[model samples]
Target: MTDRTPGFATLAVHAGAQPDPTTGARATPIYQTTSFVFNDADHAASLFGLQAFGNIYTRITNPTTSVLEERVAALEGGTAALATASGHAAQLVVMQQLLMPGDEFIAARKLYGGSINQFTHAFKSFGWNVVWADPDDIGSFQRAVTPKTKAIFIESIANPAGSITDIEAIAEVARNAGVPLIVDNTLATPYLIRPIDHGADIVVHSLTKFLGGHGNSLGGIIVDAGTFDWSKDGKYPMLSEPRPEYHGLKLQETFGNFSFAIACRVLGLRDLGPALSPFNAFLLMTGIETLPLRMQKHCENAKAIAEFLSTHKAVSAVNYSGLASSKYNALARKYAPKGAGAVFTFSLKGGYQAGVDLVSNLKLFSHLANVGDTRSLVIHPASTTHSQLDDAQKTAAGAAPDMVRVSIGIEDKEDLIADLDEALGG
Candidate 1:
């Protein structure tokens, strides 16, 4: 077949995949084996030593997962990508590759509750400190930067609250500081926005969300934009300096622009062992094929829901970026013009108990921690996801006691609205 530049839909289905060379299988077969066969001792040695890029173990790489990685990279306009067992695993790998003990990173306060815990508590054990900045204040990111700061992290559309970050502004901050800007594009998938095109040096995703739209798989991917020059200021010694593990070869010198991918694979995945399963990779690929279609409907439904909630007597405030009155509406238009995404939060006029009652009363919306599924989801963040945080922290992160988050799905708009109406009445 002739090589043709494929569009988003075509690449989602065909990129990083071809018929199996050995068996001529049309489907991406899960190489379920623990390891691969080498031609001889030298071949095995080269693979193990990282002299050649081949699967040494299932924990390091798998053929099925590789296709998923490549497809995600292409979709995100990234040079390469690494698949991991979970979104949390992907974040850990990125931190391990870029940060050393005593290094710091800046992140938006409006982030996933799990990510906040990972950055503030778990990452603290590694001697990496996170400086929190308000997503609305671009100058706050610049002010938070210290000499020890190595990276800047933000969610393209923050979890629960649906706040949209100014990727270009944040990227500028990182650029001025000579560091990489990392964005979590889980809520706003590549179909809505590709962070790399907006100046992000690296993009991360919880494929368990929209990319794995069925909510049947748990996976994550880190994509390298291949635009940042690690050797420019020698800040990232891990990439710019020689590594004894690979016979003292410098990653940037050897791998050029795609060195970040090589570093994550060789140093992070090889040591950390958070490899994504081939079965889950297959599931995620299936979901990604219809991502554009599902996301469009998701946004449309969410806009309707947000509009309804804003005018409702029971709702004190609505935080959907699609709404004209939303604090993030301008940023949404700038970064995600296609749609403001599905996940959003609103405050109940009746307070915490009413929020809980409403969640329980809803029939169509599933009360779950996940988002981006075909089915609508609801959660009381203060009682569930952000319960661990203190009152002060909870308010700072926009998870108040009266707050209820909704992940609008492709369900019938009227049905969703009626469910919310009945729930609010109760």
Candidate 2:
């Protein structure tokens, strides 16, 4: 075969997949068994000692989930990947290996509401502290980093507002601080912006969103770019120091480029126990086969709806990056030129009551909590998703009390526009 590199569309359907040798099945078969048999006594011992690459149990590894991990890694341009039960699980697994008790990480204030809550409250229980920085001001990240900082985290296309973070600039800060830059690329996906290409050391995703596309599955993944020097400052003992579980084997020394993925699997997932089910893995893989197509439609429909809202009398402001007048337009053009993505927020003229009324009045849009579904969905973030945050925290996250967020789908643009127009008193 020729050594021609496959395009994104080609990789979406074919990466890490092969026909079954025995059954000759074209689709990936779900290996439903919980435990895999070893070759013999020696083989079992080797697998247990981390000397072999075979699976022993479903909790640690499985064939179906392995395919999902490999496919996501290939798409995100990373050395290796690990899948988890959900986006929250993915975040937990990642920080577990990087932070010890009382260590800190810098995070952009413009993040998903759930993530803000997780980092602020849930992570604090483990003695991990999150220092907030503004994405609009690149210097904020630099100022937030201290001696205790181990990583910097941001989103490619932020939720609720669809603002684009300056990935390259923040990556620079992480480099000088001797810390890894972790980017959550769930909003843009690899189809739009590859975080690794912009100097991200690690890329993460909530596969349940754009990757799944149908909103039918719950999954998340972490891609190790193999760019960070985990052993350099001796900050990350989980990878640099000898591991007692593996008989004094140092992960970075042994696995080299992909050691982070290995540490997460054998150390984090093993103890945290947030395993992605093989059945969900099968569904997520199938969903990824058409990501390119679904994302295109999602972007096209979102831009059109944003334009409609920008000119409407009932709307005070629209926060879509695709709009030329939006504050985030230039950053969006630099990072996601194809389109600004499907989720964004618009403020209503009448205030918080109007935002709630608009979602109730809309016919085509489903009033729900989720995004990146085949059908369009809408929600008032201040009342639903971002309700837990205080007044200042909600505003910082782009989820203002008088704002309405929408996730456009693969529907006809005219139909979506019509729904918005009627809802806004056409």
Candidate 3:
């Protein structure tokens, strides 16, 4: 290869990887062991003290997981990244790193149902309060800020709802507030949009979805843009202040730009103990190698399905940003021009009963709670994923009772449209 930087597909396959140094194996080998042997007493001390970077325990880091982290970081245009057991685990680690007890964070109301539950309930137990804002109203985010606000969170392409958030606008709000903007780019994936390029300070992903395209592995990642100055406001004690665990060393001063990623790995991952297994890391890496190809097909099929649903008499509305009629269509063009992503929500004129009948009648679409799979999947969010929330909360989350979510897959577009047409009583 020439000095020219590799393209997305090339980097997806080769970034952060080389033939096995010891065995010369072409594929990434799984370092399945639980511990790594240090060279000597000083080496062991250096590893423990954060003075050196090498594997010590599988719980914090592993050779296989490191490759996955580096690949994801490069894909997202981030300085560094951390891999975790699941997407929720990744969120927990990042929140723990930035938030102290009694602190608050602002998040867009439209997000994954599981995330809403995690932020609203589980985080509250830790004294971390979530202030919700409407993504459709930029001023809502502005009004939600407080002196205790630590960060802002939003999904690039929100799950189920298929809304495209105005990431740059929110980044400005966070910038003016002296807080970082953390975007979960799970649905859009790096193949479609890179949040950091639009002024986001950090990006997170549930690699279990599109990144692991086959849906065979569970994983999540946090990518540090390395742009935020943790020491500027003195608000983030976890990074700005001295740490007794590492001999009173200040993380921001030592690690500079990538300090936040390091802090998540050493402090949060170490204590939290949610480690991604090496075998799963290997599977995710393989899936990523074909992400570009798979995402293209997924988007093409979803656009066709969305268009089909819009014209049908029985359909009340389609929430896909790819559709010209969608309120988020303009935002989708600005943020993700290639396509508006595959996961989207639509409602039937028959209301709740219609949604239940449509899902049950669809023979081709597998009814499931998951999205970003290689095969088409469907779910009634109000009855399943958002079941824990009350009616008001469900409506706020875009999971209205009449709505049905479909994660269009890499299947032939004609077949997908045909199946939906038949299911809709064509």
Cα RMSD (angstroms) for every candidate in the order listed? 1.7, 1.3, 1.5
**TM-score, one value per model:** 0.96, 0.97, 0.97
Per-model CA lDDT versus the true structure = 0.90, 0.92, 0.92
Stretches of model 1 off by over 4 angstroms after superposition = 1-4, 387-393
Off by over 4 Å in 2: 386-397
Clashes per model (N, Cα, C within 3 A): 0, 0, 0
Per-residue lDDT over 170-205 for candidate 2, one digit per residue giving the tens place of the 0 to 100 score: 999999999999999999989999999999998988
Report lDDT (Cα) of residue 58, candidate 3.
99
* Stronger candidate by TM-score (1 vs 2): 2
- Model 1 TM: 0.96
Report the lDDT tens digits of candidate 3 across residue range 102-145.
99999998889789899999999999999999988999999999
Tell me the lDDT of model 1 at 332. Answer: 87
Q: Write the per-residue lDDT of candidate 1 for residues 1-426, one digit (tens) a residue.
A: 997777888888888989998999988888877788898999999887777778778888889899999999999999999999999999999998889999999999888879989999999999999999987889999999999999999999987688888899899999999999999999999999999999999999999998899989999999999998998887888899999888888999888878898899889998889989889998998888888889999999999999999999999999998999987888888888999999988999898899899989999999998999999999998888778888787787788889998899898999999999999992
Off by over 4 Å in 3: 387-396
